[model samples]
Target: MTVVQIRPARSADADAIAALILPIQQQEFGIPITREAQPDLADVQGFYQQGSGNFWVAEAGGAVVGSIGLRDIGGRQAALRKMFVAPAWRGAHHGVAQGLLDTLLQWAAAQAVAEVYLGTTAQFLAAHRFYEKNGFAMVDRAALPPAFPVMAVDSRFYRLRLG
Candidate 1:
């Protein structure tokens, strides 16, 4: 089995991260999300690392196949953002998605992030199941923290409280 390394994202990883996400967002999900709308892809360190946030990438064979990030929302809360894994690297055998999320949750716990929330489009049925299986509970947008950055395409919401 090939190994996947989960590590903090570098500025140089911007293009790879975007490359990994764009196909899934545009082609797979048919979402209109563009790189222009996600400036964080262009400036991972600058944007995600500001204040109390961080971005991570899953690298395999020198290629970035997955990405996940966290934005501290203050009041011991955070917003999970930009989690995407290459289709070829998904599923339990590869563990690419799980690795990225595990890394993020581990780091969030150490940072004292008591709550983590995320928004997703209704089209992501499998993603909804994945989040639920991993302990995130579905919630209404009104239940989200005031600081949660709601995206234009986000119609479904979920939250996880870390211990």
Candidate 2:
């Protein structure tokens, strides 16, 4: 298996990341509500200028097959967001997500962040297992701010301590 390279996202990567995420959003939410719901990226040029979160893309064979980002939540925590892997590449890309996550955690540690949090729906049971395998523990949705949109009413929140 070829090793996947992880790197900070460039302006050129915004569309690719948006394309990769479109289907997952539709599948999970049953609606095409990303560029509209989020709206910054459909314009492409402005999207790159806005710089969506602290973005990163995983490259293999010169193509981005997976992506993830950390959204600064203020204080000592950052929320993991927009994590996805192309369906065809999921098997070969297991560690790629973890690698991105490990890098994000290292960055959080450097910034003295005490915790990292993520939200996902109950439908993604596999994702829940993956988070647990990586040392995250499930927490109440109330633990997150009410402002954060819950993807599902029963969406689960997970947190991992940086220490």
Candidate 3:
């Protein structure tokens, strides 16, 4: 069995991260967003590796297979973003998604992040279930903290609190 290592993302992993996420977002999810639209992808270090926030990648066999990011939004809050796993690496057998989430949660707790917010489209039914199953509660948009970063494509929001 190939070992999957989850670690902090570096500038060198930028391309692999983009490669892993673009297809899942554009082709699989049919989201019409381009690379330019998401500038964060171009500078994961500058965007996510600051304050109490971070970005991580799941690497297996020397390739990036999954990724997740935490964006510190102040007030002990953070916005979870850019979570994606390769098609073959998904599900309980691989545990890529859950592993990424677990790492994020652990890091959040260490950072004293009181709340983690995420936004996704309703079309991602599996994602909604995954977040819900992981102690994230669905919340109305208006209920989100003002500092929360709401993406243009996001319609469904969820929040998870950590002590």
Find the candidate with the highest lDDT and give its number.
Answer: 3
Candidate 2 lDDT by residue in tens digits, 1-163: 7668888787787788788888877875565465666653443334322222366788888888788767666566677767777776675235777787777777667777777788887677778888898899999987875434455334789988888
Output the lDDT of residue 51, model 3.
96
Please report how far candidate 3 places residue 104 from its true position, in Å.
0.4
TM-scores for every predicted model: 0.96, 0.81, 0.98
What's the count of clashing pairs in each model shown?
0, 0, 0
TM accuracy, model 3: 0.98
* lDDT for position 107 in model 2: 69
Per-residue lDDT, model 1, residue 13, is 89
TM-score of 1: 0.96
Badly placed stretches (over 4 Å) of model 2 are 27-32, 40-53, 92-94, 145-154
lDDT scores in order: 0.91, 0.71, 0.95
Model 1 residue pairs with clashes: none
Error of 2 at 9 (Å): 0.8
The residue-level lDDT of candidate 2 at 65 comes to 79
- Candidate 1 lDDT over 50-160, as tens digits, reads 656799999999999999999988898998999998888988899988888999899999888899999999999888999999999999999999999999999999999
Across residues 1-163, which tens digit of lDDT does each residue of candidate 3 receive? 9999999999999889989989988999999988889999999989999999999999999999999999999999999999999999999999999999999999999999999999999899999999999999999999999988889999999999897
